[model samples]
Target: MLRKPTLLLAFGIFLIGACANLIWVEPKIYMPGSTEIEVEGHGINGPVDILPRGTTAITISHEITNAGNSPVPAGYQITETVIQWVFQRNIASVGWREGDPATHTIVQLSQSGPALDPGESAVISFGPFTVGSCGLFGETLELDSTNIVVESSNQDNEDKHLFFVPSNQIINITANTINGTLYHKDGRTLTHQFRINSGGAGNQWLYTGFSWIATEGSTADAVPAPTGRVPQGPAPQLINMFVTPKDHDHSPLGFGPSVKGKVTAISTDGCVVKQKAVEVLVEHD
Candidate 1:
């Protein structure tokens, strides 16, 4: 007969072995709808440049992983991704403080072009464009995704999945003038001398001429229709000045327009723009 202590020891070993095997065994394959989606990335926060009637480019990227075991279904697709700038006062749990709500606006930065794959990732780029009306100083950037789907080769295995992944980083962009010039069509000449100043909310002050068409008067009256002014005609009032950092540096003058502005100033905490505030929007071509 086996000793009592020996039998107990054997039982203990058996239980441990059973536990180990259970841990190694694969669990039931979860239906796509049954599993959760995961997204990981650094959030965008802080000051972003807002140029009136101008464009700017910004790059956003992140990694998406399939936390669940098993292939996330053969026909799984990632439909859409978007980034928006939000102005809120609550402190983020991820260790970032939201910006003040009084003087800010949320703008959608970019939308994804194509669907993503299971356990796959991508980087999205959007263009240079004006940041419409609202000011965006001390704002917070939020990344989100939508319309995720999971399908399989089998006719009956189609499943729909949808979710969002938010980040904890803020976007900070500064406005700086790259180059400016004035052009005169009538004189057939260009002048590089022009003074530019931040016109608040990304608008700049420059000199330009305005023209209007002359109306016909009663022929019976004095003066012959005032000479040069055509009757209800269209004339070009050339506003010679131009500004930029356009992608290409080509111009009839052998160079592009000039821009005059200061670089974006960062605060000590690096969460807001110093001495400047403006709203921004992301335009994609």
Candidate 2:
């Protein structure tokens, strides 16, 4: 665990309508000392950088302080405290609700200590817990806590942490002549060769099809067209599809004139669910 600067991004809300005033600071967790990287629109904070599969990036270290002018009053001494998670969508909980299972308490301290003098402080460390890799690679850890707010200083007790993970699938492609013919004579065809590699475990990707923008006067036939749903492979998968045109009369394009096509990978595997995408350029001639 690395020791780095901590962020104190805070917020407060007041409501007098049918609803009530709500004040909260989203919870978050990350590697010991990672950069402040965030994904947009997830929450107040963005996601951190991590691996696609199972990885550990959760940590918590918070301080409790007594900032009163004098020693904490006997009646106002801190009493109960807790640290836990608040699931916004309740995905893991049945009728899934935020803060459900009531048993999800990570830490609870009642009558934790004797009265402390002013300017005193205490430290609490909750975890270095293990988090599995699942779902899209972005937001992951979020932590929330509720403490008896005898002092206004501790009102901010929420932290929404986002764990950022990158794509683990690796793919390589080199443009080659189609049907062993660089230029289509009269009855030859052109094709693009794709060499794909799934780098880590559970990295299977399915080739749904290819999407491209063609100029008005261009005409070419791409193998495994949009309707072709070819399974990518286990790991280090090799595939050949039709798309690139031959160079001039000797180009790979079997039917149309030489054309450079920008290709985006389309898939319907776990890759799609995890928001992983790969793009390549296939040009011949």
Candidate 3:
């Protein structure tokens, strides 16, 4: 027979072993670092149709699931997700205009305050928020965890997609001054004038007629305009004038020569030209 003390000691050891086994086998969940939480499920839906200067409701839903087995601590808070509007290479957190749904458009479908349990999940819904004209917009979801991951609809399977639209208006061209003896290749000097249309940037222009040559001046810096030979006729014409926004080396509203002309001379003041008598390029507003 075992002594009472020996028996008690044996029982205690057995209990300790059992407890250790339970700890080792029982599913455990650990809190994910701030960087560990990954936000996905944007392009889960296809491209959203947007109207020009109009607002549309869009739903962006995402899921937060615990990949780990351990239960996360209680009372962990998930902050609100943010959507960014990217337009014409510009990004803003706010909507394009007032009453626009796209601006800070966040609708919480579920509470983000509670600590998620192991193998549990959370769902978030944003928008019905307005989106500005047809263009690219990106959404990023952030969490209170140390491991934060951001996902965007523009990104797919590690690839990025761009959303952009062509401007409705065509390019505008303007000649501040045409101070030169415009001569045709046949050596006939003639008078010339330049004009431009008013509108947003990136408009296109079409020219027909005599070939024109254009050069940039110190203050007359402008983009190199497209050139073509003038059609043979009483009136020569050039077609298709393409204009882009002001570039560092180009005009503020887009500038280029509309006629096919030879560079007779270029001085610090301006350029001298010889053309077959080109027509003034037409501007599409």
Candidate 4:
């Protein structure tokens, strides 16, 4: 038989041990920091069309941003895969060439200096890539192109651009001068030529606007009439016109002596594709 005091003490100790076992404690979970990479189109620096038998240089610029909460390690490589599609020439309908395959050119760009912090951005440029003459050329640039970077999402890493290459000829404008000098005298006529060398793949129809302006502070004896938005085509066409100068130099209508002939080619969407301007200095002979 145990003493009363000792039995009570032992029971109390057991109750305390049981109460401790009943108590519940929550656990703390540590989630890892996530990293995300993003690419956006910045700007494109190139011509809309490449001349026949000539190559055009193209450059694509983009901005890379760290979109997640974690930092991206420095020296990590980012890849851009470029796919080129060449269009068929002389096709009645818009079509792409079958033989010319998409060239999966892989270009690698690396992060320099310190690691890219969260919400940080960097500008990157790719190519001055030489594109040969074709009817139309299309390109798709996929960033993180190789899936090399472990990002939060890979869906929005692509950008696309286009170019038109004239297989037959290029849109051109020129003037004819007997001895390389065009004298802008009253009643003197100058011959101007506009050549529309038309066949292209993507954008077949081009709108050209012609205007003549005199440089500021000089007197212009004559101004040519505007050729409002002429649509050019698949068939080659050449236009010749003459501009005769009035006695504007002595009148208030004359602006300047230096004359500039500006020809602008625009697309269907109102985008200026090509612009050519030439200035001539005329003296009273």
Q: Which ten contiguous residues of candidate 1 have the minimum total lDDT?
A: 214-223
lDDT of 3 by residue, 1-285 (tens): 669989999999665443100011111111110111111111212332222222244544445554444444544434333243322111221112112345544333323433455557655444444443433343334443332222112122121111222224333333332433222221222224434332344322322222243343111112223222211112222223222212124346687423333111011111111112233322222
Runs off by more than 4 Å, candidate 2: 1-36, 42-53, 56-59, 67-70, 73-116, 128-149, 164-285
For candidate 2, what is the TM-score?
A: 0.33
- lDDT score for residue 69 of model 1: 28
- What is residue 58's positional error in candidate 2, in angstroms? 5.3
171 Cα displacement, candidate 3 (Å) = 17
List the candidate 1 regions with Cα displacement exceeding 4 Å: 1-56, 70-103, 109-118, 128-144, 150-285
- Model 4 regions more than 4 Å off: 1-55, 89-92, 97-114, 165-168, 172-285
- Best of the two (2, 3) by TM-score: 2
Superposed by TM-score, candidate 1 places the C-alpha of residue 184 at a distance from the truth, in angstroms, of: 74
Residues 138-217, candidate 4: write the lDDT tens digits: 44445454455455566655555444443333444444443223454544444455554434433433433455665433
TM-scores, all models, native as reference: 0.22, 0.33, 0.27, 0.37
Tens-digit per-residue lDDT, 69-139, candidate 2: 44543333222223222323222311112233255433333333335466665544455554443223322
lDDT of each: 0.25, 0.35, 0.30, 0.42
Superposed by TM-score, candidate 3 places the C-alpha of residue 3 at a distance from the truth, in angstroms, of 29
Model 4 accuracy (lDDT, Cα): 0.42
